[model samples]
Target: MRRSVAVRLSALLATGALAAATGMALSTSTASAATGGVTGYATQNGGTTGGAGGQTVRATTGTAIHQALCGRASSSTPIIIQVEGTINHGNTAKVSGSSCNTAAGVIELKQISNVTIVGVGNGAVFDQLGIHIRESRNIIIQNVTVRNVKKSGSPTSNGGDAIGMESGVRNVWVDHATLEASGGESEGYDGLFDMKDNTQYVTLSYSILRNSGRGGLIGSSESDTSNGYVTFHHNLYQNIDSRTPLLRGGVSHIYNNHYKNLNESGINSRAGARAKVDNNYFEDSKDVLGTFYTDAAGYWQVSGNVFDNVTWSSRSGDNNPAGPNPTSNTSVSVPYAYTLDAANCVPSVVSQTAGANKGLKVSDGSCTPQSPDPTDPGPTDPGPTDPDPTDPPTGTNLSLGAGADGSSKASGTSYGNVIDGSTSTYWSPSGSTGSVSVKWGSATKVSKINIRQASGSGTVNSYRVVNQDTGAVLASGSGTGVISFSATSLKKITFEITGASGTPRIAEFETYAS
Candidate 1:
């Protein structure tokens, strides 16, 4: 049987289109200090015990969010800012102690310590804006969506990052949020979440990153290797071309995450970076774990990873592929205690728990006491609930090539590979562009076409679907995804590859009747 495409694709699109605590009894001030010997990933970190113990404030505008951060009674006091509406940053004034350098255009959380910015109600969205954190500590950002942050034009924020942090930052937990962009640096967009300049002790848990060219990075440059000790778990990365985290020089723990359609590269560990990769799922991607294009090499300790329908490049001097079987050069010892979900459970676990509005179902690594409700008007927070894992509306695959015949412009690859139902095999055209057509024994009704890429690297930038017998075009598009149209009876259908990045490698081209 065809691998259950509908269930996986639905979960992927639904997520692609759209923590805490603990420890000890020292004095209040001594207990909250960054050097308080706080052990867990989040307990002795940002904003937990900063201000007047647990004050929840609400903000709807960007200005209000700034004021809440600036208006804190003291830098060490902890406070929560519940954001309800869209926060289009309009403020650009530099707060003196907070070290905000940029002019008023982005939400600047500078210099302030101990703050939590969370979304409530319909959830908060930062549209065409960015959040900059510099010289800050003890921060938590949860349940928010950030999109379309630009760099070149006017009103740009954090050099186009949806969330950017640097310089003296510590103890930050970014959970259950969505960060996205339409294109890459050429389109005035940059990374989704970035950390650099001595930042440390951070955890990015249960988040979604989609349609972004750059996912994120740690340690901005080769010489800047001080930033390290970060954790990434249970996140969903979809349709992102590259940098499913380009780690420069850090000790990063990457576990239980799901990566799909990473066209160019993924998990670039270079510049002496050391990553402990365990129990992660990589599907339909290319060169998922390796050091590419750069001479500076990074190392990894990989275990229990599932690379399904993935392809790897040749091992040149600089291009080092991590696996058909990955080996560990160095061992990493994680400071805190945590649990690991199996790689197979990552897609479902991450899809249900990863982004905002799904309730905060995080593991308590330290099992510390809970703080008072962080946000006001206290929106109902639901526990993690599994979604129905069924394929979307689909019919029998009529183009399975069982009794059918097909032909392609390229001859080396068998045209029947596209209908073979197996993802492990594929048909690669001799050149970058070509066409493939299938003829049924009789007229068949077709409504949808699912194109699965075996390598997931060859780009079908534009394409056209035509009914060969009637000489009529059925569908045309730019970019790759499931293509659906009104059901039409046809004896022959041709899929013409109009544009692409490399030699086309199609794993499966399944046609269905509605």
Candidate 2:
């Protein structure tokens, strides 16, 4: 992130993190014109390597996409579908298979994983059709446009959402796409990006969501706090009423986005949702940040943000706004690292890079929009100086019954205390800093972990999550909460508390496979 140069997708093709077309050389200028690679929290949870190391197929219609999904060897098969031209209900139809669960009138990515649908050639557009994803993971959507999809009229698709994910979805990244409606809910339109039913580890970046009633929502209702660990950055939200988006539960990171013409409320985080908002630009918007509609209350950690011509209504009942002047009400610690562009330059940077077209230009990490190097730059090419960290995905806590040990334990503090499932019991280092670990009898595949410090204990300033099997550090950063890394199968994992203000008491060291 300290570097001023840009990172390109062409470079990612070389890393095998993203697969390339077999017939067509991705190094060529024709294939290298788009911004590539995933950023933000999508870089976590085993990393959303969509379609990597899989077959590459081209599709000009939605039906072909279904064909690609059904033709796969299994539901988890990795495959990339390159799309161009237009895809609509007329061309998208039901095609069921072991690898897919398809339906007519919508692009359904259900019960599938490791798939990427990217626009190619002249460009790709979905006409009045939505892309619905469920029971899936490790999917990416990029460089396309979806317009005028309706949920409740003569024609409805994906419940009127341009891109909707639910039913325990995970590790999905939607980037550089355009999602827009002609009007608001009266026009039968709905959210551009909606996630619910325990959806987690998702990112929406470098896209545009505009001209609709609701931009998006993390949960369906207050009690549906089953979804979270989502990230929104470098996108443009314009001419929308509210819910850009509405967060219900869990945590999120919102940064470096441009918000314009918000009709009513924006970022209506409620139901105890927590967001880390950083370096964003809000222009001509109303009640931009707040807990609205209900008193359940959402929280945010706001820093380095810019507000221009933004209006704030008087706080009353459900209308709790973050401005006249916004400030932090909570703290959210993520597992990833990201560089933010200056808030003042966000509008220009987003305008040139946030949509389907515009040559897939992206931030150089220094407020510069860098172009794709069709020539295929190598390792020397500017990349993420420090790849952003991700979140420990949502699932069953892995530490409840796992084995526990540490470098040392203080008197009256047993090593097993950390995994006892009760915050009242805890493990403390003999001194200010030490290490604790969770081990299993057999190899366990893990992509995320949580460190909960017992109440009234010294705060963990910095730490490293290490894979004891390979002596590799999975993640290293400051703070304690969610810590994630690439999925690694190992019998033992260590949490090294490197820096602390006082003797630390770790109440839990939880792990997850997702």
Each model's TM-score, in the order given? 0.62, 0.68
TM-score for candidate 2, residues paired by index:
0.68
Clashing pairs in 2: 335-389, 336-389, 337-388, 337-389
The segments of candidate 2 whose C-alpha lies over 4 angstroms from its true place after superposition are 1-35, 372-514
The residue-by-residue lDDT of candidate 1 on 1-514, one tens digit each, is 1110110000000111110010000111111111011223544343233322334444667765665555555665676665667777553243333423334678887776777676654568998889988998877787799999999775687799999999989888787889989888888899998999998888788889988889999988888888878888878999998888998897899998999999989999999999999989999999999887789999999888999999988898888878667788778888677777778777877876678755444322222211111121111211111111133337677767643234443565677877888877777666776677767878888777777777654876546566666434455433344555546677777676755788677777777776
Return the lDDT, model 2, position 438: 94
Local error of candidate 2 at residue 299 (angstroms): 0.2
Best-fitting candidate, scored by lDDT: 2
List all candidate RMSDs to the true structure. Answer: 19.3, 20.0
lDDT scores of the candidates, listed in order: 0.67, 0.78
